[model samples]
Target chain A: MSSHQAVREGAKQVVRLLEKFPEEKFKYLVSFKATQLERFSRIAGIPLPKKLATEVPGENKTSINEIKDIVNRTSGPLGLQKDMLRKMQAAIPHDQFTESAMKDQITALSNLVNNKYKNYYDVGDKLYKPAGNPEYYQRIIDDIQGKKKENILAGLRTVFMGR
Target chain B: MLKCTARKSSLNTVTKLYGINAAKTYNYNPVSLYSTTNKNLQADQKKQTELEFDTHGSPIVRGQKSTIPEYKLPKWKEALGEYVIKTFGLDMDKIRAGPVAGSYYYSICKEQGLQYENEPLSDSAKFFYEDLKLPKTFSQWFQITALHEWMLFVRMRAMPFKYGRNYQQKLVDKTFSDIEMRLFDEMNIHSGRIVDQYSKDFNSQLKGAVFAYDVGFYTDDTTLATAVWRNLFGGRKNIDYTHLDAVVKYIRSQLYVMSRMSDREFALGKFKFVPTKEKINKLSAQEEEEMKQKIIKKYEELDKSGLLLPSDKSNLSYDN
Candidate 1:
């Protein structure tokens, strides 16, 4: 097959993977997965498809069987089967392997990708530092104080206009 | 695209820094280390080579001077403080996951592929960089550390949500903090802008690597190997199959050991990495049941004694 055709096929596979998650619930997650898929393609020696460089909406119509079959699927150039998935599932607690748990995992993964902190607001988004840092907290405080000053000035302007 | 080329060029400099003959400097045989039958010989070998670590548990590279100065705190005072903290439960608001994950857990992951300039590797680092023929570079070490961190992530996910998430955060925070320090202290990158750029680059790299490895773990070895090749091996041609197999086995073994640990045990930082030299065997059904029961009984007795303060109380499972 031509490299162009191969790239298309790879893109299709990636889209299929993204479709497993509900688009409305995981708007940001699908986008994260898209970029990750491109990286995976590069590493696996698969062609990169230019069309999938941005977000792709998913149908979120994945059936229970498809989720179950995820354990049995083979991927990459080697096409090696991971027969130990069933065993791994059994080793872990039942609550941890459930669909709901998997959803929690999806949310957590995206949060990590976005570099969101559990405690503080994401003020370091522009600075590219982690939100957990002391410097980040100072930024958050400064941002709030700046906004308060702006609100006071606006209030005074409104009062003057009324006069 | 630009970032990819930049990394490739950086790797070229690394290759120049650690010469091609660097691999031959450490002459340990990989196969001999893997021989399970030669248990006595292995013990003797371990005794023969006494590896010393600094206060931080990081392996001292070639009797090199420590980058940071040692603490001057008296041993008795430190021990007294620890005893008082444990006995009185002075820290009430948060669990001790910070010190456990940040210090203990981070050390376990970092030591796997750690290296320094002009210093010869001794133990596990030698196994990975020499026997496995992985490139000895700073970025390569980050990949190795990231892989192990992912394994811990799998287990940490099984923990109760609140505590588990905290542990993950602590580990993540420490990993980057350590990297930043290493860059400044060890690599001597004096410029703040360059350090910040490196930190940002690493943050993104880590995010991408974690997501890719998560998919691979939930999927198959091929995907996992692909992640490893891309991140650890830098997607070079002329790969070794056995090396990949060894890594997969190493990951599986670590995960299996962690799966059986009770939440309290894990939370208290009881988990240790299984040495690559040792083989891991699956537990029998009866053995697993007994192990679970034993953990339950121990925790139950502790609960019955009413010795734990509210701060020390944990709702996480002692058995599963």
Candidate 2:
């Protein structure tokens, strides 16, 4: 299947899993998925889906489903999807999620994902995020391409393990 | 301006026969009388008879020796006594016995270039006259008068006379003739009592005596009379007379002390001075920093307590 088609299918499966989880586990699922997508986006050199960007201000600007599909197609064999599903299932019983904690986690995860994408641009495009300046999409794409082989491997691992 | 006239006396014929001019009778010339033949002959006879006859007289001289007689030195005590008696018409004995005699004699000896013989009165007179350069009687009188006048002047100047009201303004406004008359009147009042008390026989001589007394009291040569005048009249003229008197007395006393001390070389004397070193301890950099920290801690505590006002915060801020 095409990369876009595979990304859409993976997004549908994630939505089904989220609906089945208790409300308290929703934050864990979102954070785990956001983290996994961030890894995928850095490796692929693509903007995050728009739905994910709406969920967090600094995430990739792509639809949520699109980001999920991209992660599933590119990162499924690496096992990030299975790992996040399992963590969500485990967190549901312990009251392991709280609104404030979830916000903190989301913010932290967003920053980490943004930094990873910024790093990709820094290496590949010779497009340094000058000490204080912001990173751009084209520079990120070029950066990811320059390190395409290693990032793809890492991306596969992040998808499978949800690191 | 008193004039005296005297009647001339006519000489008798016997007097004319003696070659005396009758018209000019009173102050007759004795030498002129001797020049007349009759008188000349009598004088010659008297001189020849008085002289001792010398058998081997070398070239007989007819008249007294041509050489002038050695000046007969007058005895100072006698001459001065006579002068005092005649000049002041006072008893010589009284003055000679008085405290001023030494100064009087000293003046005479100085004038004549004579040395004193340790006579107390003569020496004292000489000392006072030469050193102070004032006549004995005059110096004594001057000392008293000067003290009186200085006291009066100081008191008068000191008398807190306000600018518009005092005699000074009046002096400025009045015409010379009017001022003179006013001055005469003031002088009459001012000196009248003094004259009455000191000497009722106030003549030129008495005035001279009073002047001498005044001068004697104020004769400090260092600042001189001009400075005295300036001190007396300069600046605010309306100061309290009593205060001015006290100030003058203080200044005079200070001046006297200064004058006396100025003649001595204190530095070379036993009172030589030395300076001592002073020990100074200063704060080190560490101490300064510690002090700053302590102050900062105090301010922080104050701020935390909310005790500091807005003004305090504004002052505390670095940006301010």
Candidate 3:
């Protein structure tokens, strides 16, 4: 993807990740090392969502108060810290998210967020032998030329006949 | 009704003299149940089934799972109704055996996707399976399976404790591995990576989606309709609520179809699953009459053969 597209998608991902991330899983982020927290801030390229997480450069020991303050803060327009405000903490630096424990989960989620187009070229990466994924390549060409006639007919049948 | 009674009596005579009607009465082994006896009755039963069970049937409603709790056929209606069900050729027992839930759990993983193209929709309607525009790609195939999986998962939630838990474990495991395998084979993700990455993410999303989606099923119509709109249409501002209304109708239509299916019909994996966004429309009186006539004709062969239930064609309630 172009840098511009990546930036746009990445911003959307951040919003979604905050909205839908597991609350319990993200609680670990509050206990992150001072350096790890800074790394997260750099990646996000923004100040921490809540004011309690003041930027501390290169400090070996970041105060746990940073996370505690944010978690304690109430979400506006509602007395409770619910909705987006609650889950944004999940974006905080947490070792468990990057470790092998959640490694597969990260790749899967990242791929989903990337909306990586399922291309003909990708299939050839692993299945490349003599002809590679030539069959897949041909199928893609057929699909593009025909504009997926098979699916269109399938849709028509489903509509009219309730198949 | 008189016509059905005459056929019922006549069917008994044939049974006593020829032992020909034995199989359908047993409600087992639907395929072998009808080598002869009444060829046209089989066609009639399928058509009637499509209407009574598939078209008009609704979801279990409220807490019922998969099917309504009990049919409670009225005493006066029993003889005729039984005859109708039998004439239609159900053999509910055989359909129940299905493919055997865990027979080849690991091996059955990752269907060739559009695998229905290989089987007929039923013994009749030879053309039904043909030209379904089966999913050509793995992802498209995933969508088909995903729809069924979602429906089944929702139903499982409403099931009784023991069976509900058991079905949930078995179905979820089978579905996930199949999807994981699809990623490995078609998308060519490394097998190792699939377990470490894709499976974990997929599981989380599956849980999130199920929770988000099933709420609509458990709630009232308006909530369900809105949920359907947001999920299916991406909550686009330009799309009208009429489209959502159509979707709600289509969902009820499919659920009605599911409620009507025998266990074998469901578990045997022979149903269609592509999206039907604009497929079904509200029918006019003329069209309604036309549909009724067409369905009625399907049973004519059986009626003429004197196997119809109750007493006759006129006695039957064609539309309730």
lDDT of each: 0.58, 0.32, 0.39
**TM-score per candidate:** 0.51, 0.13, 0.30
Instruction: Give me the runs in candidate 3 sitting further than 4 Å from their true place.
Output: A1-163, B1-144, B156-161, B229-243, B261-320
Instruction: Give model 3's TM-score versus the native structure.
Output: 0.30
Model 3 per-residue lDDT tens digits across residues B36-110? 777776665453322111212222222223333244656867677667656886543232222223222222222
Q: Rank the candidates by lDDT, best first.
A: 1, 3, 2
Name model 2 segments beyond 4 Å from true: A1-163, B1-127, B138-140, B143-145, B148-320
lDDT of 3 by residue, A1-163 (tens): 3554444344344334333322221121232223322433444455554532554422666554565666566545245455665564442323322223233333433432232212211212122111112233233334434655556776586456432
- Model 1 stretches with alpha carbons more than 4 Å out: A1-163, B1-93, B118-120, B306-313
Error of 1 at B141 (Å): 0.9
User: For model 1, how does the per-residue alpha-carbon lDDT over B1-320 read when each residue is reduced to its tens digit?
Assistant: 00011111212322211234433543445566668998986765554333222234323222334322242557787678667766886642235777678767887898888776545675889878877777677888988898889888767766655566688889999898888878887788999899989999888888877766655454445455556656676654334434554666566567667767777788878898987788777777799899889889999998889986454666666775
Residue range A1-163, candidate 1, lDDT tens digits: 4554544454344334433432221122223334445544553356555566322323576643565478346452134345655544443333212334333334433333222221122111212222222132233334433543335665586456321
Instruction: Grade the docking of candidate 2.
Output: incorrect
Summed over model 3, clashes come to 18
Indicate whether candidate 2 or candidate 3 has the larger DockQ: 3
Candidate 2 or 1, higher DockQ? 1
